[model samples]
Target chain A: MARVYNWQLGREMSYWYPESRPKKQFAAVFDTNKCIACQTCTLACKTTWTSGKGQEYMLFNNVETKPYGSYPLAYDVKLLNMIEAGKWSGKTYEGQTIFESAPAGERVMGWRPEQVDYSYPNTGEDDCSGQVDHGALMQLPHMNWFFYLARICNHCTYPACLASCPRGSIYKRPEDGIVLVDQGRCRGYQECVRGCPYKKVFFNPMTGTSEKCIACFPKIEQGLQPQCFVNCIGKIRMAGFLNTPDKARADNPLDYLVHIKKVALPLFPQYGLEPNVYYIPPVHVPASFNRQLFGPGADAAVETYKSARKDMDLAGLLCLFGCSESLMTRWKRTGDIVVGMDDSGTQLVRVPISEPVHVRTSFDPVQKLVRINCP
Target chain B: MRRRKLIVLPALVVLLFVAGCKKAPVQTTEVIAVAAAQLPSSPTDAAWDNVPEYLAKLIPQDLVEPRLAQASTPEVRVQAITNGTDVAFRLRWLDSEQNDTAKPGSFVDACAVQVPTKLMPNPPAPQMGEAGGGVQIVYWRADWQAWVNGREDNIKSIYPNAEVTHYPFQAQSLEKGSPEQKEMAKRYAPADAVGNRRQSPRQSPVESLLAEGPGTLASNPAVAVKGSGVRTQDGWAVMMVRPLPEGLAPKKRTSVAFAVWQGSNKEGGARKMRSGWAPLAVEEKKP
Candidate 1:
């Protein structure tokens, strides 16, 4: 008979375990199908939180087309290409999420959008007391379809940001799970900036601190939604709790992470950060494309993905989950997202596999939704 | 039976009294560390008194440097310079002659400057020793402009001598990265470790000042000073100032900051002032 260890009831187990961290993990689900790229969410966040000095060029929230779309220039392609070209291998330390191995002075490369070649358009200078030729002629080429993707810090279950911070400046709150950058303690290593796969953590020269989306915990504490979630014009976003692993891994967090798609598919699961944010792949984009982007196990991963994406598609998932809904909608309506969902098909949920959630011998999995089986 | 009943009653009474005493209210301070110290009741005339004296020896007050041309308002002007796919722009004054090379695009764009100024005592003597010198700030407008290249942008403000003396910004504003955008250039910035991109210029000046330490109200009329600098046991800070410069608009409120020195060294203090500069919005009180 399987022993049921009740933590709340204070049942003693044979094994001794340290107290769990106060901060819990969270997940976001996005439905790409309902997305209508208006960029209202983008403006809401930028104007409200990031509209400060150094943030002028930063879109803490941005929408991008798949295939060729990316903010800060071809961010995905650059990273993907490096991995594919064997120039970079996702980091692994004793199979645990240590830090990405350094490539002899090669910091993780980033794309500066300003370096790209494109056209600019004139935004009429109606308010410049006198005529200031303040407009750009740059215009993106129109295409058959596009989808938007909003992005922000994933606040992952096993956040790469937490692992990468050398000074331990970044911490996830035990009470609410919101990741925070302690301004006074941060030495500004910028390692977290490079270590984070999402590239959400940014450096600020003004305060000499690293700043990111706070998930508006101040509001969350009051049972209020985050600024982005509340202001999402499409109403495609939601704030909710995420499930944590009951058992401890001997070596790797990613090992347990990618497999969750059998039940919580992460966006670009192949990248292997074990991100908490999940998405339902868009409709127009072929399932094959998802397989390629997510990996050969994409179908097998659908269950995990579906649990995360019960409501939203990839673009929608990214938008609703983070602080970038406005950009997601904008990119969705525009041809910016090269790898967007196709306009056909109604595949919303992934086929569920009756896999039992595993629990550690010392602890039992508490049910919020999925059934947990403790060993 | 009567004696037994009397014993039980006294025991119950003592027990009840002990329980009541255990339920005492927790003691807590009503005032937060921040609220305890108030802003200076009057303007600081000390910092201002030395401005004229310093400017007199540094450069001719009447010296017509085109770069120092005064704008009617204190607002810093903006302009966009380039427009192609690989967009790049220059920042300069609004009324000043356009730099074929530089232009201000948006009020929300970021910019950098390397000024050699520091916090000074009354008579404006440089105090806090020279730490790393020359800090860069990214400037931006509160309003949104399309993320594009070659967009001419301008913002309005109402402050005195607000025109940018360094017309034609040699470096790109915060919209783009800076040359010293790495950690190795520590001497130029004391706090910058996350590179310059993280600095949000949109933060209100008051919030930024409050993040620093504790200060008391300065009551010296000679300086119209409203606050005194206070050091804490652990060295965190909070400060406030009042009676800002006359002739300044409401937007130009003053926020004071102090840099403490390990020891008082006359020559060291003078050198520190020549090297370091604090982000200031404070104005001098008139004599």
Candidate 2:
């Protein structure tokens, strides 16, 4: 008799889920509608974590103004433009992802929050107060067309940072799904830096370790919101425990996850990292713009967005997981997918709502975008 | 009258002593010693304390001063080492003031070299080479080299030296041992003087040929005979030594080479060999 060897033996074995996966994750949901572009979050993260000598320009949490906006300097457009202009191609190896390849001698944009330095050198002053040069432009846009997206760590599902770490230093908590990199074990390969689509990971050259948001585990452990969330003047961000399949969560794969009249949406699902951060699609954008940002046939995008929002059905597809072609088709055909209600009952999202809520339509002084609008 | 005065004086003295009676005496405890020998002999003995020196000089300047800590003689400069392994080492530092302090928080804003493990005389280590086997050199060619003619070519950029040539096939045979070896093996009979005559007078053994006996054989020879495929070559024996370094990670597919003791009966088994394994560097294109 031929001996049938079991491939899944030892580490090749069964699923090993740790006990009481500490829901130690610290998460933040920035209500993009409420961001004022005041850069308070950027400053808070800066003064708290990135104030060290090399971190003069480092911003842990930043507010990026999209569609003509950026993080002070707006690296998104520049990077996106490069990527779109066929100047950049993602790294690939033997049909596998090896590392990100940039053109030889291509200049990596440094973190420049402003065009000019604002702080006086060697002053040791906590606040940034400097004499302005007339030649320098301060808030120079003749017309402000960008919307603010105040971002921190998503504490994503299947976090790219955790997966790309070669040293096995990065780990995601089973309970709360909070991903973290162990400072002691990191060899500073910067794989996480290259793999992270959002470019959230920062390399501390001194420690030679990649550092990002810890998700404020202490705050989460105490059952309070994170500092950024609490301090956010717009009050759009929400922190919650994303449920797993074993433990049924408030949202379901089908009903809420699929687009219904009311639902939430995901950002860049094609990145395929399974982000935990869910969004209520910015309403009122043009159909083509929505299709390009979300995907083609977003009437289906609306349906899937609804399934993500609503807590009702799990035809076994959660936004946490990619959906089947059938589900996508159903969503496309019937734009009535219902997403679940948020922590607060104020905003009700659905697939194919009467209309889209465009961020450019109106702006609030405190919250950069208006949350509630008539379709 | 004098006697009466004395008795009164004596009685007065006793009464005064009684009036001055005090409470219990307070005891002072002796100081306990942890051991006088435990103190570091000199300040320089504490060299390993600076953990920050492990980082290279390329570290951005802003991170330097804040993390630099100083200590006394045997001045320890600790730095985080993010090399093949994430281990910290102590080194020297130069401070802005240029004054050397041995206490904690004293250091220079510079980098240091890796400590060589080979220098320590009585350093903590396990036994090298097992009881039966020690250092031995075996020659069976197992190197990939570009051949010129039918002989092993010494390619400068590819190989180490003129003497060090790589054979396309994995193993080779060593001939006429070194002067040191010839002297050590004086007791053994020479190939020509031996009773076993497997070849004619014109044919010489691989050892004799390598020993300047004849230079007619091919440059790269195959050690393995046809039909028998053996991955582990026992002929290329080595004197197994100490265990690998604690920090060295072992890959599943690794190559090992060594020297072994040679014997007449067992033709190819080597003795007293030094075995080592090196990581094969595979080049990859950056993404």
Candidate 3:
């Protein structure tokens, strides 16, 4: 065991191996407020990568309606309960991580879901917390609430799957920090499937091994966002590189949202994997519920998001999302426009933080014509 | 005085018994490898009748990581018959379930025979041996036996209704049986594309593994170690055949070890029941 710095926990914690970060960590920020549960990103990833013989149940990217829904049944709730008692002590978590909580002779404290656990990918799809009684909303506000939660492999800085593989098959790519399973080395042990708390890694029975989301490295190498990020219907996703706090740059869009403004937070940071994908908590969700899902920062993130329109830098970066197919390494706001640039400072996209508004009256006097919209 | 006489009476009887003994009682179990005209190819082979059988008691392998949480098989009966060129050993053990399918969160019945690669005045540690003195393990699995028994290794074989899509390698995506189609199919089956031995077709039901200490098991699929397993009424019976282990021949003294995994109990990899090294005393063939 080695003590490594987990930035999410804001303290050094026990990890299987010493901390060694990638040169450029592949990362993304998802705006939960903008997501509408329209699974365009899901089908985009499904048709592109997971539509195969053995991958029938594998959803590399899935959007579940949260508060009453989950893929693989209750993958999140189960893990959250397994590694329970891990409460945050202000910024630093005082509880043991999955690695630290592992029992004698085990690498990580984890449980493998039964084959039947995967039978229902969308078990509680679109279900809300409370029921609606006919037209109750007309008389009084309905209590029901749900939000779309789009998920992909977090590609952690300290990947539990990489640590639990007895044969050392799963690895975090040092170039991009993308966790991957080396197909040749893997022997269908399913230790990775058991180790991952998020239940992202899946066992492909046809191939007799495990497979997970590759983060679309091919497109990333070609300087483009992944298929899911580009195809997001609500423009809720932005793919970029995130830097650690010590080296965070204001120009980097991921760092700006994740570090500078400190609005976007990693999911389940208490698990101590230091997951790269960050999420801007939904404004409508209760702070208590959001805190458990995101972290102690979820309340602050939601508050910041509620006031985003007043902050041009925050609103500017949100506009730049899903506006381009190319990956933006650096971004900046200039007046009403947000310019997204590649690593070489080549402008990839220019999105206006505020859109121009033009309204026409019902009657056009000059042409002696009456114009009515949406009759 | 009476208590002393009672103790000395038994002691004098034991002294007479000790003086009558021809040689010192053998401390280690000597598995006499009776040189045979032909090795036993299967557990039911008649050639094994002429060879000596040694029953080894098994204990849960809790020495290393991923320790077996529970006990499964209690013991295994071992027999060895060797030809000059090749040696074959038969392992029979008690198991209630004949689990021959490998699935996620499930394991298959398996057994492995470990033979020391480096020999000398002192034998290596029985737990996969030491660094300089490694062990060559011939591992056999029930699922591989199913494969050798003509079971197709595909989704349809396991879940007949599973995975009915236009195979990316087929007509809809690419021309069937074309080079491009083959490459496209490999995309879906990454393990097979990279030639992971587990995903590849099985000619024999055994894998030849080399281990130098714990958690260092490595196997090359190219190296052939032939074996077969069959489900018995009480348990399982398996036969492992390979070239004579490094330093074994007629009139040679060596040792061997065994390990067993019960699939229904979720035993595999480091979680298993194993036995210590049982000395082998090779004997010349009778005319």
Highest TM-score: which candidate?
3
Residue A321's C-alpha lDDT in candidate 2? 23
DockQ of each: 0.06, 0.01, 0.39
Off by over 4 Å in 3: A129-143, A367-369, B1-28, B221-223
Tens digits of lDDT, candidate 1, A181-256: 7664663435555556676776543343556777766776654556767677666565555444454221212212
Q: What does chain B score (TM) in every candidate?
A: 0.19, 0.14, 0.85
Instruction: Give the per-residue lDDT digits (tens) of candidate 2, residues A1-375.
Output: 111111111011111122233453333333344567676656656545554322333455766545433333333343445444221122111111111222221112112112122222112221122344453334343232334556666675545566455335678866667777666455343456544656676654323345677666666655545566555655555565544323433342323332332233344433333355655444444544444333333345445444534532432223212111111211211233433233343223333323455564455767776656566
Each prediction's TM-score versus the true structure: 0.39, 0.37, 0.91
lDDT of 3: 0.83
Ranking under DockQ, best-scoring first? 3, 1, 2
Q: Per-residue error at B226 for model 2, in Å?
A: 49
- The numbered model that scores best in lDDT is 3
lDDT (Cα, tens digit) per residue for candidate 1, span B1-287: 99999999999999999888734322211101111112222123222211211110011111111011121212221111111111111122122211111111111211111112222232121211123321111111211111122222221121122243321222344222454433223322223332332222222212111111001111122322112211224221112232322322222321112221111111011111111222223222223
**lDDT of each residue in A213-319, candidate 3, tens digit only:** 99999999899999999999899999988899999999999999999888999988888899999999988877888988888898888888889989999999899
Off by over 4 Å in 2: A1-28, A71-144, A244-262, A294-375, B1-287
Give the higher-TM-score candidate: 1 or 2: 1
Estimate the TM-score for candidate 3.
0.91
Model 2 chain A: weakest 10-residue lDDT segment is A5-14
